[model samples]
Target: MDVPRGFSAIESSAEIVNMPLSMCCDWQGFTYTMSGWHYLCEMLREYKLKPKNNYRKSILKKYYDKYQPYSTFECFLCEEEYDPLRHSTPWVPLPWESAFRIRLSDNQHFGPNSNTFIRKEFVRTISLYHRLESQGYQPQENKDGYIRGHFLKKGDDYRFKVSGGQHRMAALGVLGQKDLHVKIQPDWKRVIDIQHIHHWEHVKNGTYSEEAARKIFNFYFETTGIEKAKKYGLL
Candidate 1:
């Protein structure tokens, strides 16, 4: 029995080895690679899965260019690729750029400016200008030109004493100009009488209720007017 069993009597065995390796991470959700860290994106060559379409591919390319590993915790506003970041502002109308003649007269006038409708009008004008330009019309003049004035800080918390561009300035703020740098046009001083007209009517004629004026003033002093109507509370 021993002689016959020789090789047949012995047997070999293999054991499965389990290492402490981490899960795999994906590159732009294309190809996935093994790594200890999450939110991983690999080199472009290593990109595995093709985008669903050309749009997706384009988006991926844009994301690849500006994306940094540490930016995961940052706000989208901090990204240069953000939509708002596309336009540099206090956007001046260029010579070649076609736009409508936006004049201060075409807009409503107010002192220390009205919080209402100013933003709406500014946005409307800009939007129209963009549309017209797209259609190949050039604006010969900007009637609704703005004037610039720096804040002459009065005291603690520094109240701004209406230096210039009261209406257009309010409009710009409402329109959200973080990079606005255009100087305020100098002619705003000539329009002071017209400016006071709106205020006189509203304040004296009571076009705006006393309660409304108080609320509007309080809202402006408090928030950036982004959430004014919603955040406003009556005393």
Candidate 2:
């Protein structure tokens, strides 16, 4: 687990209450244990961390998988598409009402990376937004004060890739309702980073084939210099 770059522990707690401590701990542990900084350097050496690579990784495969068949749908939006055979009433750790992340690019060319599990979880989030809106959740006026300006990570530019709560945002956009408040409690980035790293590691290690790994690795690492070969010591 890597201590997410931008925010400090104190700032994290004060700014976002729901920030996942487990994620923070995991990131800190991984970087400390694994000597992960060298991976960043290697990526720079290979030129695999370019923005073009990241764009390809994040966008292309997502479009492909969206067209592929999925097995289940645990949330509202996906409830219509996929089925929950067993655990008919199983619940996820995160609740429906919690303030979560949502990326601006969704299902489009530069949608969230498929390697990130948060993308799948977010399918249900759209329905949550619909539910809230249907129940007469009013829009806010001073939207700038809302959670729109939150950073993805300390060092990373651009907003954090939203793991959930996208539908609410879209509804607000469609309604031209800037008054809605988007709250961000940042904890998942550590976990997300872990997942991102693990997925590529699996790919590079031959657990997942080269084809599947290529798009995924290139997408996230392109801009960040997060290469599988360097990060996992394959090089």
Candidate 3:
């Protein structure tokens, strides 16, 4: 599979170590880990916030409307008549839809799909939480035997960006596991420079200058990253 210019598949032997859960991040390099599911679990536990299916649809429609503009392709959600599942061409999200999904994930609103998938994930997250709580997180049980990712170091602070086993990582996080056994790839530092991560965060927070953020974003994701960032006003 082709990756971005600045990214590569994990090819080197990974070093396994126990690292703090708070230091781990999702694939987008964000510190927020399964926050949406966490929120759902909390609501269920504390407030019994279960609404009817129609009510759920009403809530999800708001999110769909908000993120639909960011979609570039004629997916089933956007096009009233087009159905990619039946078409000869396999549909994939373009940069715009990808950007839309990122924002949706950040807000704990999984979409570009119906509420069914989101609800399924919520159920799965709950299942995972119970399994981890009972099973005690055995690394050997996982196919990879560990949560796989790479460590990004900015000065003394480190963040592990998960490349695999995100669901399990999120489960551990939700369970309040302070640390995890992780497999850190050796080539991450060479592919994703720490400075790039720093600049990206600065861009997200509107702390970095546009010119500088563009340069770093371009390096990380080529022109497409810059375009998405600008479209979302992150740069």
Candidate 4:
């Protein structure tokens, strides 16, 4: 393959579905592998080294909001009922919705965005989805019901997180679908926490404001007629 000046061309066709332009040329990721492409993408996801907020924003701009929101409203990814505000039951503060997605195929970041966790069931679902995909079946997603999360510009790294679609994302990860859809809530930290999604009530430095809290409780009340929200845990 005739190569250019700076690009480290992937001569191996076994894994060379798309070629991402290298940072040596100051490009974001694969020139040919735009996110919408059916296969995995290769983008520079190394937010740790390049911690510049602009680069993080660029990733969000380039990859996020490409798809529309889901039409039908539901509580959270685990919940099935149509409850827009996710507070009906004291569901774990940080369940699947609190995870940040890491698309390993996107060569944008230098190393993997670490520390994100998922349920064991997530893996099983991925295998199922993979089998279905092999049978020529791809699932559907939308704006309202798609993965909602954030890729925050943090200390020498951008944190990839989730607001919904835990299982769907796991399937993508299992299938190596790096170039997929994302709804990045840049201010997600202010509203959610991946590390402490299950323990938010104890966090003092950043807590969901009363108005937001009330709104969620209101959702709970509307769904199940519960007036009081859960109490804040002891510090």
- 1-235 in candidate 1: lDDT tens per residue? 1221111111211111111111100111111122111111211112224322232233222332333222210111122322233233322221111232323222232112233443443344445434433542221245433233211111223112233333333323323332222222243221112223335334454333344333333322343322211221200
Q: What does each candidate score in C-alpha RMSD?
A: 30.0, 16.5, 11.7, 20.2
**Residue 133 lDDT (model 1):** 36
Give the higher-TM-score candidate: 3 or 4. Answer: 3
Per-residue accuracy of model 2 over 19-77 as CA lDDT, tens digit each = 22112111101110122222212222222234334422432343324323122122111
How far residue 34's Cα lies from its native spot in candidate 2, in Å, is 42
Spell out the clash pairs found in candidate 3.
Answer: none
> Of the candidates numbered 1 and 3, which has the greater TM-score value?
3
Residue-level lDDT for 70 in candidate 3? 31
Please give the TM-score that candidate 1 achieves against the real structure. 0.22
Which candidate has the top score in TM-score?
3
TM-score of 3: 0.50
**How close is every model to the real structure, measured as TM-score?**
0.22, 0.27, 0.50, 0.27
Consecutive 10-residue window with the lowest summed lDDT within model 4? 226-235
lDDT of 4 by residue, 97-138 (tens): 343333432222222222222212223343545564575223
| Candidate 2 minimal-lDDT segment of 10 residues | 24-33
Q: In candidate 4, how many clashes are counted? A: 29
